[model samples]
Target chain A: MNHLLEVNNLEINFKTYGGEVKAVRDVSFHVDKGEVVAIVGESGSGKSVTVQSIMGLIPTPPGVIKGGSIKFQGKELLRASKREMRKVKGSKIGMIFQDPMTSLNPTMIVGKQIAEGLITHQKLSKQEAKKKAIEMIKQVGIPNPEERYNQFPHEFSGGMRQRVMIAIALACNPELLIADEPTTALDVTIQAQVLELMKKLQKDTQTAIILITHDLGVVAETAQRVMVMYGGIMVESATVFDLFENPKHPYTWGLLNSIPNLEGTEKKQLIPIEGSPPDLFSPPKGCPFAPRCKYAMDICLEEMPGDYQIDESHSARCWLNDSRAPKVEMPFTLEKEKTVTVGGESID
Target chain B: MTKNLVEVQSLKKYFKIKSDVTVKSVDDISFYIRKGETFGLVGESGSGKSTLGKTLVGIQAASDGDIIYNGQNIKQLNKEMKRNVNKEMQIIFQDPHASLNPRMRVGDIIAEGIDAYKLFSGKDRTNRIYELLERVGLSPQHAKRYPHEFSGGQRQRIGIARALAVEPKFIVADEPISALDVSIQAQVINLLEDLKVSEDLTYLFIAHDLGMVKHISDRIGVMYLGKMMELSNSDDMFTNPLHPYTQALLSAIPKTNPRDAKRERIVLAGDPPSPTNPPSGCRFRTRCPHAMEVCALQEPQWKEVEKEHWTACHLY
Candidate 1:
């Protein structure tokens, strides 16, 4: 596989008033060329911090990438000079955020935000940039992109503003696009629209996408491979089918159980994963999910299990995967799990 | 099956933009919540779910509507009667952090309703507040702390306690869990369910998450641009959604698969037209994938396709 981006032992820390807050710890994942990878986790699970570290968006005084290696197309990002980092930031890597209201300048027109990146990088003239901006917006499914070009962010609906955000991110035609919960705040219908737009754009442009979200439904629709994170650690990483159908990790099972499938015939009361996400302040001793995992063993609490490889492309961190550990299948909550596994295709 | 706890009839809220183009925030939307039942209203931002919420709670005046709480129109109530009706109707806002006052302690915030009604003594106030805190999964002692000290989930719990303080019969919960984490969203929802049953409460739960809405509601109402696009039993809505908007919405939810993430998606083209200058006929006609020439010129009548399953779409 041709990897577009790769990270190794990415450890990020924040210097707080009390002490150093370990945001991300020994996290590693790779995105392949033209592939869509989802980094799924709840808030404070280091999903955001890891990506911020990627774009060098985190404020260094309080936040620091203590130790890590970020390589994009075989070029080291952390080791790159300021000039080199600038070339890579918008030229090769694009990013869209959760809140478009904040991501976009309220005073500026939507077209300008998109054109800024193009003009800055491609050095296009005002007329050329405007034309491309409208085209990009139209491609993202924003209605009447030319008229909407002059409209401010507030003038657009939540779904439309998100579309604008996508247009701006793809303005420079980067190889990789990192969207942090692009649709979390949107309504289901609007969220669906944005997700569809993203998928279509990716198909048309063959742009690799890194989607970071807590919603498992999003993971199922938009990711080719998923990296399930908890407490700054990758709990599981596998192909979408492999992860959902033959889910190895107990945490993944917990997530699967928690997903409220609207399309299904049964309205099974979601057996939510008990307990809160592990606190980042005083980090847990071993596996962060051990407290919430239904199949936690003595080894899980005392010593975190090493990687258990399912296949060349699939891996998980859980003691239950060990051959010596007890074999216990966690009960699934889906009504028609047998029939609904394979054709559990896209809802939209 | 039972007498309605809250009745909304032709509820319309319109604002006069400086240009005389009326921005219909809630345009002729009507629904009723039965006693002790949860009526879930689902919609996108600008779909006016929150506007309907505020109108029902009497926080925002309805331009043309009758909000009959109990047996009286709240708008027509006398000053004293209005106060009494207001006391029985409470709302839990989307952002709990902003909804709650920072300076006030949690106990006082919760007890404000109790205090307003002059129902509890100073000595009993603490106990009542304590009871509410514990009921919402917070420690009784946490009442002494400020809102800022609580996490997003905990803050929402505090907000719930505050609403339940007066023992309101009907609660308008507007996107209460949308701001919380997914894992915690379920917890808060479960807590709300428990509270509704234990207290014999009627709830108007408004949210954008169809799954969560279906999980807790007896009936779900799908809204688009201030109109009730579809209304049906929770089970039926998911099983056989009739409205084009509803079907598209149901389909649009990103499936939880990582491998097929980049598949061909049906993204609706264009932004929703401005409400002030809404397109003729159907509000959703401009963005409807199945929209027709008739759709642009004439609005569809809201009719029942099956027993108790009502949808507003030309095709339906």
Candidate 2:
């Protein structure tokens, strides 16, 4: 399948007052046309930075994309000139940011914000954009679209503001959308509604999605393919089922175990991985996860592991998956993943 | 009943937007937390989950309710009584970064609560502070450092340590782990659990993350637009969600397992209605997937839908 957007060997760094922070390092992934791809990791795992780089939204004064290519529809976005890239930004690739409150202009009426994007990208007339903006408000399921059009961003709820943001992004009907933890700030029920709306819109627009979120549960629901990041490195990449059912990376296993599961609610105590992410200012010499990984080998501490192929589609960067190393038991959830399937279909 | 540690009865916290209209933030919601049990309050952003927690802890005075802690109404607490009660009922704020005093040393911040209750002398307080620091898995030496010195998880631990300094019998942990990294959230939660066991403390653990909240809470209360929509044991709430909202919330929780096909997701029509200008009666009626005319006009009476399981939806 031809990819709508492809990121190859992406590297990003932030010039902090203290020093340079290597936020994203040598990461690569692709989103097929109309496909929903999830970039999953804990905070500081460079998930957000990777997607932000794709849109050229990362500020250069501090955030600098040092290397790699971001190609959208075979167009080299990373190397594209400022004037040339501006044409593609909203018209071809729209972005819905993480926090709607901060993302939307506070003073401007929500409808006008949507209108501005359409006018800027498509050169829609004010009259045409106004009618189109109201139509968009309806499309995203906002109640009283006319009244809402006159109200500021603050007038809308957290979820509604997000909808308005989505409406703005989709008003131009961009071929691709980059949502960076779009619903993380929302409540669970509201998050569900927004996510459902996004998925539904994807069905209609067929816009390829780069959904960035740390929450594993959201990843499971939304993504067809999953890219797991740890300490600026893409540790694993696979289909959601393959990654969950047969996790090979020790970091991924730790992540699975750490999640508070409904099935395991009976257990009184939860097993928590001790320690923290290595400081980006000065990362460790080898595998970033080795310090906390229970299955960490001596070699893991000394050198980075090569990507180990689990299947044709699934690959994990872990020493434990090295055939030379001894095998380890799977996390309790993955053990269940071996059998569980949607629609009650048995898979082994 | 072994004398419930905290009893909230008919809690009606309504904000008077104007002379005529009122936003019912926590209307007629009631629950009790017994000694040494974790009771989780679960809901979305506008669900009044946080308001209910704040009311129980007296962070905000209830509009029309009784927060009876050990036979004393928290709303009626005098200056001295309020000061005394403050020790046994501390709140863990949602944003650890915003909650802590940036200018002051962390040691001073923790000790401020201790000094308020006057649990120990100057020397004893210093020693107690160090012990509390280590209890939350922070270095005792970190006491000298400012709030910015520690990571997000560590800063939250400082907040937890401050809450413990007063040696509170009950704590209202208001989304304590939401702002943390997934890698560090478990550690903080486990620390809270450990402290709960050691201190024999009751907790009103409020969060949007049902999965994380379920792990610690024995019984869970589901709130929506300032009302207790559903209340049940952790097992029952997950296994047999009564209210439509609860069912929707459960289905929404992203499970990592791939073979599990997404359930028929209850996509509520619109966002949660605003509290200030809430819909006529049943607040959830606007976005409720199974809403009816009766739901629009009449507020659903809270009742025991099943044995030990409570729900406030007409559909039940």
Candidate 3:
């Protein structure tokens, strides 16, 4: 089945003073129609690069897409010309950045900013675009849409600015919305509201969303499927339930264990993944997570592991998944009531 | 009972932007940090959590009320006595990037406080800086490098090292981990926890992230628009929150488990009001789900609603 968006063998690099930084390497993923797919990773993990390349937003002088095929609705995006990319960018693909403070135009009135995309892509008249922009503002749950239409970005608060961002992204009713850490800047209550708004809008518009965030809780709440990235590589891809209940990669395990459980009664010591991320300037030949992995074998440091299919809906890149390797118990489990089993032996 | 390391009574910090317009950042707030215990302060931006933290550490002078440290009022302290008290209290800022001096070496940044108090000189100061660097998980070799050379996590470690340089009895960690990545945040949190025990330190842990604050703090206080809404034991506050604001704040946190994702969330409406002209009665009433007639008419008194649990709410 054809997906709304598909990325295959995506390799991105940056020219630096010291050496060429391998920002992203051999990453592959897909987003089905109206589905929410999340890319979870820390800083320098290339999650942003993967999505930025989708919208043709990466600058070329320092950033170079060495190899990849980004297909949107079966059309090749990576090789598209500037004019061709422009047509697809706002109309077919919309993006929300991390900071609403800088992303939105400060001088321009926000309503016109929302209307600019509609006027360009849909070729609507000025009056009609104005009417639609106000409607879009209202649709995003912003109060006093008509009054707010004339106001600048500075007039709105952080949460309201994000809401305006949502209004702009969904203005032309794009098929896919890419939100890069959309609520990372907002407070928790405001984040909850914004996430709720996005979910509601997604349900109404049937827009496929690619959410890029490091917060697992946000991923759990919104994403249907999760792609855990490390050292610019896709380490694990699984359904949200499977990712939380039975995460396969050690990197994923470390992420899950590090966050304190809000609902938990007992105060458990956080098991932080020791050491920092791999230096991308000269990335390791083997698994990017091998040095941090406690169960790292000799072969893990020698060669990069291929994708090991755990089930129909889950896959992980790790040497431990090999049949020859010894079975190891998972250090953490989300299922508090039941025993978790790995390779058939139950762990109590 | 454990002695209160620091006691704050009705402390107020107001910033005047205009001649007439006054922003009450920390308004009539009172709390105490027990000896060697972490007191977590949770609130959103513009809620005055940072202002209260700054006031406690003497970075900003309180507009009103008294701050008693070790049973002596800090306001009454002489210049010499104040200097001695200032050395005991230090702060770790939120942004690791902005906190450290860009031109200074990591070693000199850590030694600034040591030199200010004249606690050590020459070889002793160098050794102290090295010891602090290693204690926070960075190697002693890192002292020679500049702040620009380190990552966000490592820069935070340098900040921690600098704070520890003074050998402060009480430290105000103002959203130290908020600037870091999730995995890196845990590493720094563990470092702080370890140092708290070994160095015999008390912390005024201020952050918007409720989950991490709950993990580290013995007691937790919920602040809204420069007022303390609730205060209680960490576990009790989570399980049985009294203030409507606290309940909503707790519920607003996204659940990690997919099964628990659909749980009801009391998402507050609109952004928190500006501190310059805050709501007349209860500061949280404008956005609160359970706002009563009295909520807008009168400010609720801060009283102990339950045993060892304090709340300022009309519901109580």
Candidate 4:
């Protein structure tokens, strides 16, 4: 079966006064028709840059896609013409941004904003688009759609505006939806509502979602597969269960140990990953995380490790995964006996 | 029994936007912080948790009621006594980017309190700044650099160092780690925990992140629309939440392990009512799943429902 989207050896750089900053280096991944994939990383890890390139949203003067291949449904997106890419953007692929306040047009009616996409892509009449826009509003769980149709973005609350964003993204029924830190700005209760809505919409529409977030809990709650990115590189990719049960990369281990577990009774001292993220302007030739990795060997500092397959569905980029390397025990584990049911029910 | 370091009585902070319209950001909330304990405040955006913290620290003057520090009401103190009390309480704001002055060197910024209090001068002042830098996990070389030169986590350390410069007994850390990256957030949290012990400090830690708050705080308070909904020990708050709103809030947190059974979330209906015109009687009645008729007719009395656990709800 062909992947709905395939990204291979993507290398992106930005031109600054200092030098060319290698924003993304040799990152590769794929998404099935209805799969949910999460890319987890800290700031400057190139998670946003990788997704922005897929949408052809990167500014050319500052951002340069040095080398890569982005194939959506077997068609090469990198070499596509401007007109062709434009046709594929909103009609075939949709995106929801981080900040709802700044992303929406303050002057225009939100209902019109949702209708505009339908008119442009589906070529519906004005009246037909307006009717469908109200329906779309209702579909996203916003009440009193008829009255809300005439309101501007400023009139809507943050959560309601985000509902508007979701309505706009799913208005065209795009096969792929990209959400970049969609709930990071909202409170936990509000975040829960938005995540639930996104999950329901994905199920009903059968849309493949590429969720970009720095939150590990959000990843566990919503995604099936997880990709851990560090210093512009894809460090690890595994099923969410495998990733959480037995994370392979040192960076992944660091991330797991850093956060305080909500279910755990004892207050453990957080073992933070010492030192800061690597400078992208002059990315290290070897492992970018080597300087911070506690288990770093001489080989890790001198050479970049290749992807080592742990199983058919799991892979990690670390020298320690090599057969020749010494076996080391992970400092943390989520024991089966310790796992407590959240709210005590299956999500499905 | 440990003494209460700070006690608040019927504290209220209201903002008047129109002739008749008033935004009661912190309305009739009473609580106390025990000596050397970290009190966590959790709430949604318009919940006014920040306002309550500000009022306790005297950053925002309370419209009514009293704030008692070590049994002496702050409002009753004279100018000199008030100034001394002010020095013992300081605040670390949420945004690291906006809090520090960009033009000032980090050393001078940290020495702002040191100079104001006349605690040290010349080399002793410089050494004090250096000692603070190392204490928060920064090097002495960082003193000469400006705030713009450091990362979010490093800048927060500078903020912490400045808070400790005056040798304050209490600090209001308002969402200090919210702006940082995940790994960076951990580093800052660990730093705060270390400082609380070495400095013998009491913290009013205000944040929306429940997990971090639960990890750092000895006691926890839940706020909604300028009202204190519940207050209890951190462990009891999580394990046996009594308030309907508290239960919903705890259920809303995403699970850390994917394999764990999905939480049967008690999803509240609609956004929180606007603070400008909150619902009559109980502020949370409009969205409460268990709202009763009395909840809308009369406001619930803030009472101790169980030993050491307090909540304001008619259900009790």
Candidate 5:
């Protein structure tokens, strides 16, 4: 597989008043060319930290990438010079954030924001950049791009503002687009529009995407492959089908079961993960999810489980996947033969 | 069948921006919540679901409508009667962090309703607060800490405790769990379910997530541009949607299972029209996939299309 981006032993921590808060620990994943890889995790799971490190957006004073190797297209990002990093920031790799309201500049016009990246990275003239910015805005499904170009960020609604953010990110035509919860702030209908727009744009541009989100529904919709993160560690990485169908990790099972599905009848009970996400400040030893894992074993608590390869492209960091460990059924059986009462004698 | 706890009739809440221009946030919508049942009001942002919730709780004044709580119209209640009605209705806001006071301790925040009604005092008050905290899955120790100390989910629990303090019969939870993490959302949802059953409470659950609403709600009302597009039992609405807007909204929800590729998504063309200048006829006509000339020319009548299923669409 032609890898567009790769990270090895990515360790990131924050220097707090009391102690060093380990945000991302020994995380490694690779995004293939023209592939959409989703990094799914709850808040404080280090999903955002790993992506921020990719864009060099992590503030060094508080956020220090203690140890890691980030290679974008075989070029080392951490070791890249200031001048080189600038060239790579917007032109090679672009990023869109969760809140478009704050991510966008209040003082500047929306069009000018997109133009700035084009002018800086593509070395386009001001007028040319503005023209291209309008095109980029229209490409992201924003209507009346020419008229919208003159408006400030406040003039646009939440979903339109997100379109502007996408316009800016894709303006320079970067090879990789890192969208950190792009549709999280938008409403469901608008979220659907944005996700569809992203899928269409990805197909048209063939831009590899790194989607960081906590919603499993979104993972199933957009991602081809998924990396499940927990307590600053990658618990599982597999194709979306394999991850959803034959999930190996207990945490993944919990996440999959936690979400209420639209296809089936509303289950009487949603099997929520018993405990909250592990605290990063004093993260537990061994498996970070051992406390919440239903099939947790003695080895799971005593020592960290290494990544056990399930197939050529699938792997999970769980003791349950070990050959020596006794076979354990996944905590939640997703497709139970649900008997539909309303539909009469039908099985799902 | 349960009796109606609260009934809203032609509730209209419009905000005047200038001399003549007004934003019709909630324009003449009617719905009723059964006792001990969850009535879900779902719509995107600016669809007036929150405004309707506020109107139901008596927080926002209605332009013209009747909110019948128990037996009396809350809008027409006397000062004493209004105070008594206020004791029975409560609301949980969307942003838990902003809804809570930073300076006040969790105990004082939860006890605000208790203190207002003069329910308890001193040792009894403290015990009540402690019980409320523990009921919401928080410890008694949590009462001493400020709102900033608790996590987003925990803060929401405190909000629930505060709402439960007054023993409110009808609670309007406006996107209460939307701000929490996915895992924490289930915990808060489960807590709310447990409390509802134990306290014999009725809920007007307002949210934008259809899937989550379907799980908790017995009946659902789909709103579009301040108008009720579809209202039906949760299962019937999801299984056999009548309104085009409801169908689009249901299809918009992202499916979780990748293998079940049978579901087709309906991506709406554009964002909803501004409430200030809503469409002439059907509010959803501009975005409706099956829009016709009549749809743009005349407003659709809200009619019962099937047994216990009501919809506002020209297609029906």
Candidate 6:
């Protein structure tokens, strides 16, 4: 796999009334060509901020990327000029936001809006852009594409509006797609359809996708690799199989345990992480998650743990991963075992 | 004789658009909730789940049918009886940011119901407010702070505290945790469960997420555009769904386990038909992969396929 995009030592801060909010702190990751990597995190985990920085779309004054190197196709993005960034924004790297209603122009016709990208990026004529716009709409699985093309954003439903947004993003055939919680607003069925559409599009176009979402289910289904973020940093990174089967970080375990299973099994108690996310204004001196982490040691409070390698592709940032720390079992797995043993005894 | 906490018979809520057109938000839906049980309502956007919730809480008046609350038809109740019924039924809205009053302190917002009924006076009311705040996992000092001072999850807890202040027997949690983060979502769900037991509360938990619904609900109801598609116990619904729509919905829930990555997914085609001009007969027929000719020609009857398991489909 060839590297398509690489973000190294990324740091972002938002100047708030309270203080300087360290939104994204020393985050690093990379996406390979034709590969899907999911950045999984809660609201303030900096997953969205990292992606926004990559797109050079983060607002200034209030928002600032303190230090980072974002390289796309061997070209540095942080140092890129405004004109250069604009040319690369939609044409080279397409983005789909969570709310399609806000992203789309309320007054503009859907087709004309899509055609604008093609006209600017591909240098297509008015007639060509219109024709391509209709074709793109049809490709995204919107029924009666011609009719939908002329309708306004308000005319479409939530799911249909999302498809329109997808059509616009994929119009110029960008090599990379950065989808920020694209299907969060849609229902489960519609989300399934949109995800399926994205997988199919990737197969045909060979576009590398960086899917940023808090949904582990989405990550398991669509992404090959996963990066679990906490306190504005990547706590754990691994292949989908490894992450689910042999998760290392305590935060990852908490996330997996918090979600209710949908396999028609008896409901198990969800082990929610205690306390809320750390305040970004003055982040913890050591580990950001130490306050909520059950396995916190004395060192965990005073010093941060670096990424300890588990294998060639899997790594986690936790004191438990350190050789000096005592071995500890994952909480959910232990709870499951206890239940299983009790059930076995009851059967006897 | 079995007593139902709340019962609905052929409920309909229609919104008029201009002079001719009308949006059939909730059209001819009937169901009942047993005491101390969470009834889950799941659907896509514009499926009328919120409309059903609003109508039940009397925020939106039903255009037709009856709402029997504690053995009295709510629509037919006198002004005095209606005021009394309001004390038993309350709602926790989806957006806590918008639901809570910006001008009032947390204490006043939670005491609004108490004050309306003159349930308590000056010092006693303050004591009750502080107790309610602590019950929902908030600090007693939080009562003095405004809504803006609280986080999204904290604000939702305040919403719960306000609902509990009146000692409501039934609460409508209309996507209460959807706006929260995933980790915070679990906390809210657990808090709701804890309160349900301590307060002896019955909830109409309306949300689109199937996993979260199954966790908190004893029974689940799936709705399509302005119509109920399926209803059954939560376990039975997931294990053996009869309706095609229900099965598709269950299948669409992305499995968290990576080993289940190869799980067969049923991706429904096209968006749900508009409620204003829903398809003739079954509303789900337009998007149903198993759609037959009769599905378009005639509406399916709501049938009890098995004991306490109901579905609306021609195949069943």
TM-score per prediction, in order, is 0.91, 0.92, 0.97, 0.98, 0.95, 0.96
Tens-place lDDT digits, model 4, residues B181-225: 888888899889989999999999999999999999999999999
Cα displacement (angstroms), candidate 1, residue A213, comes to 1.7
Clashing pairs in 2: A217-B254, A341-B259, A342-B259, A342-B261
For candidate 2, the docking band is medium
DockQ for every prediction shown: 0.54, 0.66, 0.82, 0.79, 0.66, 0.70
State the displacement of the C-alpha of residue A56, model 5, in Å, after optimal TM-score superposition.
Answer: 1.2
CAPRI-style class, candidate 3:
high
Candidate 1 stretches with Cα past 4 Å from truth are A106-138, A142-161, A333-348, B17-21, B257-267, B292-294
lDDT for each residue of candidate 2 in A1-348, tens digit (9 for 90 to 100)? 667888899999999999999999888878888888888898899998888777778898898889999888888988888998899888888898889999888988888999998888888899999999999999999878989899998887898889999998899999998898899888776787898899999999999888899888888888999999999999999998877777788778667767876774446455666788888898777898888877777898899887778887788888888779986766454543442222211112
Candidate 2 residues lying further than 4 Å off, grouped into runs, are A123-131, A144-151, A335-348, B17-21, B73-82
Instruction: Compare candidates 2 and 3 on lDDT and give the better one.
Output: 3
lDDT of 6 by residue, A1-348 (tens): 447998899999999889999999888889989999999999889999999999998999899889979999989999999999988999999999999999999999999999999999899999999999999999999989988889999999888899999899999999899999999988888899999999999999999999989889999999999999999989999999989888999899889878887764667767677789998888888899999887788998898889899999899989899889988776544234443311111111
Model 3, span A1-348: residue lDDT tens: 999998999999999899999999999899999999999999999999999999998999799999989999999999999999999998899999999999999999999999999999999999999999999999999999999999999999999999999998999999999999999999998998999999999999999999999999999999999999999999999999999988888889889878987775676667788889999988888999998887888999999999999998899999889999889767768855342323211222
Best by DockQ: 3
Winner on TM-score between 2 and 3 is 3
List, residue by residue over B1-316, the lDDT tens digit for candidate 2: 5678888899888778799988788888777877778999988776788888887777888878788898888778798898778668889999999999999999999998877666787789889989999888888899999999888999999999999888889899999999998878888898898898898889999988888888889899988878888999899999899898888878878666666646676656666766778787677787777889999889888899899899988897
Give the better candidate number (2 or 4) by TM-score.
4
lDDT of each: 0.84, 0.84, 0.92, 0.92, 0.88, 0.90
Q: TM-score of model 4 relative to the true fold?
A: 0.98
Single out the weakest 10-residue window by summed lDDT for candidate 3 chain A. A339-348
TM-score of 2: 0.92
lDDT of 5 at B289: 83
